[model samples]
Target chain A: MAQLLPSVWRHIPERYSLLGSHCENCGKDYFPQRPICPTCRRKGKIVQKLMPREGKIFSHTLVHAAPAGFELEAPYHLAIVELKNGVHLLSQIVDSDSEAIQINSPVKMVFRKISEDGKQGAIAYGYKFKVVRNAAAASKPGKPVGKQSTSSKK
Target chain B: MNRSGIVGYGTSVPRMRIKVGEIAKVWGKDGERVSSGLGIIEKSVPALDEDSATLAVEAARVAVEAGKINPQKIGAVFVGSESKPYAVKPTATVVAQAVGASVHMTAADLEFACKAGTAAIQACMGMVASGMIEYGLAIGSDTAQGKPGDALEYSAGGGAAAYVIGKPAESIAVIEDTYSFTTDTPDFWRRQHEEFPEHGGRFTAEPAYFKHVVSATRGLLEKTGMKIGDFDFVVFHQPNGKFPGRAAKILGVPDEKIKQGLITPILGNTYSASSMVGLASVLDVAKAGERILMTSYGSGAGSDSFWFTVTDKIEEEGRRQPESVFEMLKDKVNVDYATYAKHRRKIKSL
Candidate 1:
């Protein structure tokens, strides 16, 4: 817990939220944020952009084998999501049927416990995707608040 | 002092539920009798990765969005829960950062058993009313735990509710007044380093829940000179489906008056989130001028009661977006006892 605190502290902003960096010059977005834009280099004006929480599934895989600290959540689905901003990022798909998961399926982000150190350790939290249900009634994937707000009320 | 009011509210219920029958079957008890006795058909269960902090953050995000206010402007954040993720660290800080609250703000974890969430609200009301802050975010969230085979297991559940409080003019519901009744009657308690809480059984009634609820409620009604008939809706802390009804009867309130907010039968007791969630459900369908009375009970034990009047802003702001409590309640999947155990950590790997 002690050794992991610093990294956890540093990543709290991005981990606890769906924050990405947007390049004013290139109009491109990057998840986990980027200090510099590769497309426009020094001329790029980098700003923290609140990324959309809804997206379409690009691809997915099932994790049958458990990793350290994730044994209990074995056989969870992981997918590369094409966010509304067109930034494809990898995240786990939870709270939905495995058979229901498919490519191009609409997904939305939710706050969930990602990991914990142990009995008395700090619980690490992050955003995870879930296959959106009630698609026909779905208004739209998302609406960015003031341009940078995360996800739609949908 | 500036008047404080509820600008916006949000709820978070996990996707999983374990029916009373599923849990009762594991203990060889009659499922029908157990559910009928407790008036709970099923209880919400959190995912393996979900806890008080995560669920609280979910609710808070919706509230922040619904309030249409910048998170940076929220001057205080208080999370009330019995099942905080970290024992040493503050869950309020996690929610504060998660909601993008300003660095120049106050945040803390509050505990008062089930009413802790309402207590968080009262604290914010104080700070806001005193002109100390423009707005405050109060949350009640819990991934409540109960011992296997214990009576509480059938009703203890996971859920969260968040309320963004600001000035009356900016509120969707104006808070009229609040009252509380407290005493050192240990109806329920979890010892240090204990996994589950212990209770005084029927003692939780009469001397604990009832005493506090009735007293606090009548106290507030007297203070405001409002009659039971004046309230269009009433919400009382429900440890089980039966208790709220019984409390209403004792208060001379009609059974139907609290029917809308009596959600414990479907969602189980969300602990600190209990009454706050109930109030949110009522506000979902309440009209612009409707009056509401809410009382919350936490087993340490005490009751915090309040009066609120819905405003035209409730209709203007709308209720369905970000999902209402009724909507979230409908989006659920029932898990078996084994899966429930695994999720609740009743079946730990070590």
Candidate 2:
């Protein structure tokens, strides 16, 4: 708990809202935020920037061998998503089919639980990307009301 | 930022679900019987990473984004949940920070069973109406739990809803009036360290949910001089598909009034977010100038009744989002019982 809490606290902006840094000079974006731009050095004008919530899949892989903490979530899809500004971040793909995941597929960010320290430890939350099934009208409104599956009355 | 109305609204339902039959099979019971008895098909299952806090954050983020309201003006944040991730810490703070709300705001977590969400709404109304803040974010969410074979396992589900309350002129719906009725009827409760709650079975009906809900609703009608037919829509705490209808019957609200808001059959009982999500559902398709009546019940027990008048801003550009209640309901992924247990942490490996 002690080791995990401090790190999560320090990276709240990045983890919660995807706050990163963008260099105006070299026109590059960074995750985990960089104080000094490597390309332009001191001459670069770097400012805090919020990465876009929508991106495209640059590359992906199927991880059947789960890590120590993520044993329950074996055989998951891990991908590197390319943001709008060309910044790429490695993350897990969730709520999508293995066949549906392809390079350059449009995806959107969603908040989700990342990991927990252990039994009775702090729960960490961050963004995960999902393949976009439908960008417009995920479901239509003003449909006549109907029973989903079960009857209300006995 | 006019007095006390809903400026922004959003809802979140986890994509994963476990059918009642899957759960019933594990317990060696008739799946069809249990499904019919509870009036539920399946319930939303939180992914391994989702909990009360994550759900709240997602819903609140959508509320802020959909309404196009600047988070800097939000003055208070109140999260209502019985399934908070941290017992000693406040989930409201996590939500406030996630949405980039200003630091100079009051925040806390509240609990009172399913109606806790409405309680938070009432608190925000008072604060905004009294000039304590410019705007307040109220959230209701839960990752409800149940014992392996308990009846609650059939109906308990996970979801969240968030509302941004501010002046009526800037709101999508103006909250006309509100009322509450409370009594020490202990029909259902969970002790300090208990994981799942216990209920009084049939006693949960007439004397608890009906008594408080009916009383508060009737009291509101009497106080506001409004009758059942004056409301175009009615929403009640949906612990199950049958309970809301039974309560509405006692209140003289027609079945059509409950039709638009009764989503429990598909999503199950979202606990604190139950009635609040119904309000969001009604707001999704309600015409401007339409009237809505809502009542929420928490089983310790008490009920809160509210009246709303949808404003023209509801249909205005940029105020509404694509993530409607109906859409969240449609976006679902089916999972088996073993996967459900693993995702919900019921099969802990630590």
Candidate 3:
């Protein structure tokens, strides 16, 4: 609990807003906002960038074994998502069934509670991905499509 | 008023829902009776990870995207909620940072029971209308609390709504007029450190919800010289499904005019977000040149009323992604009583 405050504060920018660094020279984006671009070293033009929340699953794995502090959410799906800007990051997939998540599945970012420090400690929040099963269906005008079934197609 | 209006608006309801029957089953009460009495079918329940702050951020992000404004230009952020996660910290700062608003922006948290969200809106209108800010974001969100097996549990819900207020030229709907009515009516309250609020039962309606809402609406109409029939739509704060419908009849507004904004029957009462979300739902499908009347009530208690005229810009801005309130309501996942209890943190572990 003592170290929780600093760690939480340090990750605020990246966790909350997906703040990252962009290397103008190579046009590459990096999450966690690196201070210096590896390609150009001191000559690199690095600036703060906000990655688009929309993305697709690059790779994913199901974690049946629970990690400490994540016991209640055990058997959850963890995925490596590649943002529209081509930056990849690891995050937990939520608000959908495991069967609905596939390689290259379209996804969107959502802020959610990641974990709690203790029974009476501070709660940590960060980004998670939810599968957008039918992008086309969601865009259509008129009434909203009720209940997103795993079988629905865009 | 200095020609300020709503540049953009967005709403969010938690995906998880618990039907009236589920709660009824656990308490061994007649589901149909409770459902009929409250006029609510289901209520959104936040996931273990979701709270007022998160809901506010989601709604604010959608509003920002719709407005197509630079986050750096926003001058203020106000979040109104009865369920702010922290007692000491301001939820507005977290919302401002999460939405990438400028660091120099003013931020604060507000509480006025259910009407707190509209109070934030009134504040933003003042700042924007005075030319003191380029744009201001006002948000109302809540994970409303109700005691275990209490009547409040059936209607208390979780959700949020956000609005971006700016110059009239950039607005989707121009603010025609606004009014407020306040008093020391204690129809409902939650004491310090109390887990849930206590209400005066039927007293919550007569002298509190209905009284404030009716007075505010009448005041706005009388001040603006607009009759009930002049408005295209009407929205009232929905503590329960029945109150808004009743208020509409009392104000001489037809049922058809209020139907579009009557979302409480399905989404339950989102406390601070109730009326705001209903207004957003109405705006989603409203056409250019139409007028909207809105009134919000907060137990403790008071009401705020506003009149808006939709512009052509609403057609374009209302179609943006993240979907509308209707879409969010349709796309829901139902959970049983056990899951609801777990999600709501109602089940305690020693």
Candidate 4:
């Protein structure tokens, strides 16, 4: 089963892991495993492991003009996710409208497709964050509109 | 006169190989068609993880290994490629970090289509000549992607070459004279952040390759007070083997002198890196006091010609490096077309 798809298997662990690299020499953490330790200039001591999947959006931008490979996926939000480990990751914000995304908004990582060159294999299932919607707006005194689940009994 | 030359050199190519028959099968074309029409039998492709930056790092490592130059002493690193990984970011910074160049050195990217590699070398020469820095590294590398089944795909491949330029006396090859011919014409162009390049094929064949190369070569010869007969060798930007040969015949450079050490037959059209890689191969065979006339052209319409005479100092430095260019070519492993697609990540339906 695994022999048929080798690259797919390599990416399975990346699906859920908020991956980051820890510098063995300086004890510094980087969102992506750096080839060298920036603090120490030491080589070969940086090790890779999982990072926190939940964080707040530090900053974001809506890209209107993407590269040739990402043209069709335009108008998507790209955000800098600040994880608990002090490592910042640049990722796409998905499953939520761009209007709701604000600085410092709490978000959780979810798997989503970035884009495919169509000729190259699609970059499958990478990390993205979503802002949890507020519940108070759905329920009001005059209208119990949040009761969609309750009405399901009919 | 400061000696600025290649102290070391390195190269990296994808392990996977793609053959002509495989491409012919997929595209419903004949294997002979790709090999004969495009002048490429096989091309080295980069894996999904490999980009221009990574390939430059691979080449820079080889350059460093061939010399006694200190990493911290390197005052600048320049990467020239049309296929940079990011639009806003500087690829030189990533490549510098990858090869462990000094953090304080100036790092930047240069673009001039295929002529960019030689352009970077000219820039390095300027900096070294001015005494702004002690040593600088100029790299020309690319992971050029041609559209599937397009005529370009057959000749586009992934590779890189790095040269360390410094004082000429201490260098391998000293820059003698440089001549440039520039015009505003779009023979071929790729817009910002574009994956595929657009071209006016027949126009480029005439005006871009033949017209510019002859003019630039003649310009350098006249300026340097030397003629075609004085040079032991000539190197030109090679989009394909046939084009350079045709240009050579037009310039009266002779088939034997022009064909020696030409790399497109194996490495494919590396865009900006093509001519410089060929130059590096020529340097391997060039002797002290032997004159070399090199002409470089970019697709947007620009060419630079330089005259150089090898020094005895470089001949000694050559021995400290890897086995000759021929050995490296023998060490390579060839692959088929499907693997090429996978390496370049060109097949993605699921």
Candidate 5:
């Protein structure tokens, strides 16, 4: 019989965000948060910044050569997305085709497991974006899988 | 000038190589398929589990094999790549751990189209020059895949190179001055999360390759007040063999100076590490008194040029690795076009 490992599931803040620091002096943004602005070579005066999850696919590719342990998931799409706040990012595209992914396909932020640490067995979790559906999909009669409530907006 | 030359070097070419004839067969063409106007005969594909980060680790492993210091003393690990395995995930941590670097160190990834490798070196050199650490490792590796038959595919290959930055006494070469120029232009760019990059070829050729590289190299020479003739060698980013040749002529650098880094004729363009890896090759046979000038260009219109002076330390670090830069390139592994498509996962269901 397959055994389930003990798991510690926790919500990573309702206002979860990928915080960055935008130099008030030069307007360049640093991701994963930086104390000092790199461009201005300034010390400690940059403003706290938060970029939204919603945006569009600026470009994308189907990863036919899947990473190790992801062979079955070959041809999965990876995208470069631009968020509404003008932040550009790279992410995986869920439930879509590589060809159909265009320059401006709308997307929304979500959280998913990226990879397991090769050693120590720690699982890493991070925020990513997926395609945003139309009003029709939102108003559908049945609840869809993988849908999370948007009440805890960042 | 402080010596920041390559102390160690390594590369990763896929076990399998796919040929043009095989690609022609899959498309059901009798012969001579244009392959989308890119003159790529084949490409190296990673196994299902391999990625840029893993390849970077392999390259670094080879580079450090003959190096004098213990791996545990490495103060920083920097990876320069455009096709990183994860968007938000920093591959440097994994690479650092894999290479047995000190836990307390700076680790990060850099991306500037293909110039990511040299940028990582510049950052490492800054730390080394500051005497913050005894040694720093910089790697440029990529598994950049071009859309089927696109212009970029033929020239894009999977590869990596590593350099250990340390004190001049133990260093093979010391880094001199570095100069860079930047402009906001979209000659060639991959948007935030894009897979395939977009380019205006003529525009990319002129501005991204010609204009910026010329300006930056001239700017560096002007700042240092050194003539092109003073350098024993020159290495430029290899978007294609032709681009560097053209740029070399335009900049008054000699043909032999440009010839030192033509691995692209066999391996294709390796984004960020293209020029630095070539410099590593030049360092393999360079004498203690030689001088090298390196120039790198990235998309979005930016260029970095730096000076290097070879030292006697190169003689002390003889071959002690499984795959020295020369040995790695000499081995063979080939795959057909169908396998290339299968490896790249290019087939689409109708």
Candidate 6:
């Protein structure tokens, strides 16, 4: 429980807000906020950036036997999502049907409970990706879709 | 009345639901009787991992996105809930961090039974109206508790609603007036170590819920000099599907005016989120120039009432989110009583 606190604190900026870093020289973005761009090494000018929340699944797998503390969520889908900025994020896919996930499936970031230490320990929360079925209508160029009106109204 | 109002609003309800029939079957009660008595068909049950904070973050994310403002500009965040995951920590700070609000901000958790959410709204209204902050967020969320075979087990639900309050010029709905009525009425309460709340049953209705709600509504109307007919819609705190309707009738509001917000039949009473979620549902379809009156009652007990006028910006802002309360309601997976127990962690097998 003591060790979990610092780990949760260290990842807050990246986990909560998708804070990443971009290399000024190579025009490439790195998630998890790398302090130095591997490609540029000494010359890299890294600046903090917030990646777009919308992305597409680059790959995925079914986790039938989840690790310790994740037994309740067995058979959940885990995916590597590539945001529009070309940065890949390894995240658990939630609020979705496992059978429906496919390569290139559009996804969106959502805040969800990642895990809990115990019955009384601190519950860790962060970002998870969820499959967005209506990619076409949702990914329209200028307008935001699901964010606007409630279902009955539209 | 100051120039402060709701910039954006959003609601989140868990996908899992347990039917009243399912609950009644386990207790050997008449499912039909239980359903009719509570005016609830089903109630949302949070996943074993989900709680008030997660629900608040989800709702607040949608609200912040819909508002289309820099999250860094939000100066305050308040979360109202009786089921906060941590008894010691502030749920508001977690919500603020999740929503990407700036580090320099004021935040706190509030509790006032079901009306706690509206209390948060009142605080945000005051801050925005006073120009103390550029944007303030008020959220009501809960994973309400109900002991096994208890009457509350039929209606206690899980959900959340978040509102972004700011200057009227940047708002989708403009605040006309707000009022609160309170008294030392302990119609319901949960002690520090108690898992489920205790209620006065029949006593909760007349003196606690109805009295405060009616008083707050009438007080707002009188203070604002607005007639019942002047408002296009009305929303009342829903402990059951019947309470809001009964309160509306007593206040002379037409059934149609309250119908859109009367979602308790399907969502159950989400405790702190009940009336705020109803108001969000109403705002989803309300048109420009439409006036809405909302009054919320919390056990222990008190009420807060607000008058709002929908602005033209609502047409655009309302379309920003892909999901709505109605969609969340329609999209659900039903669980039987045993599964409900497993999800709610009622069956301890240690």
RMSD of each: 5.9, 3.6, 5.2, 20.3, 19.8, 4.1
DockQ of each: 0.23, 0.36, 0.24, 0.01, 0.01, 0.26
Question: Which parts of model 3 are misplaced by more than 4 Å?
Answer: A40-43, A141-154, B317-322
Cα lDDT tens digits for candidate 4, B126-228? 8888899887888888888788887777778777878877777666677787888888778988876666888897888887777888888999888877878
The candidate scoring highest on DockQ is 2
Stretches > 4 Å off in candidate 5: A1-154, B1-5, B20-42, B317-326, B348-350
Model 4 regions lying over 4 Å from their true place: A1-154, B1-8, B317-320
- Interface RMSD, one decimal, each candidate: 13.9, 8.0, 12.2, 35.0, 28.4, 9.2
Question: Which number leads on TM-score?
Answer: 2
lDDT of 2 by residue, B1-350 (tens): 22599999888888888898889999999999989888889999998878999889989988887767889999999999999999998999999989999899999999999999999999999999999998899999999988778888888999999999998888999999999999999998888998788999999999999999999999989998988778888899999888898888888877887887887888889999999888888887787888889999999999999999989998887676466687777778889988888777776462
True contacts kept of each: 0.30, 0.40, 0.25, 0.00, 0.00, 0.22
Q: Write the per-residue lDDT of candidate 5 for residues B101-154, one digit (tens) a residue.
A: 767898999988888888888888888878887788888888777777666666
Model 1 TM-score (2 dp):
0.94
**Model 1 native-contact share:** 0.30
Can you write out model 1's per-residue Cα lDDT over B61-119, one digit (the tens) per residue? 88888888888999999999999887778999989988999899999999999999999
Candidate 3 lDDT, tens digit per residue, A23-92?
A: 9988889997899999899889999998999999999999989788777777789999999999999999
What is model 3's DockQ versus the real complex? 0.24
CAPRI rating of model 4: incorrect
Weakest 10 consecutive residues, lDDT, candidate 4 chain B?
Answer: B317-326
Shift in Å, residue A153, candidate 1: 34
Among the candidates, what TM-score does chain A have in each? Answer: 0.86, 0.87, 0.88, 0.67, 0.65, 0.85
Please estimate how well model 3 matches the true structure, expressed as its whole-model Cα lDDT.
Answer: 0.87
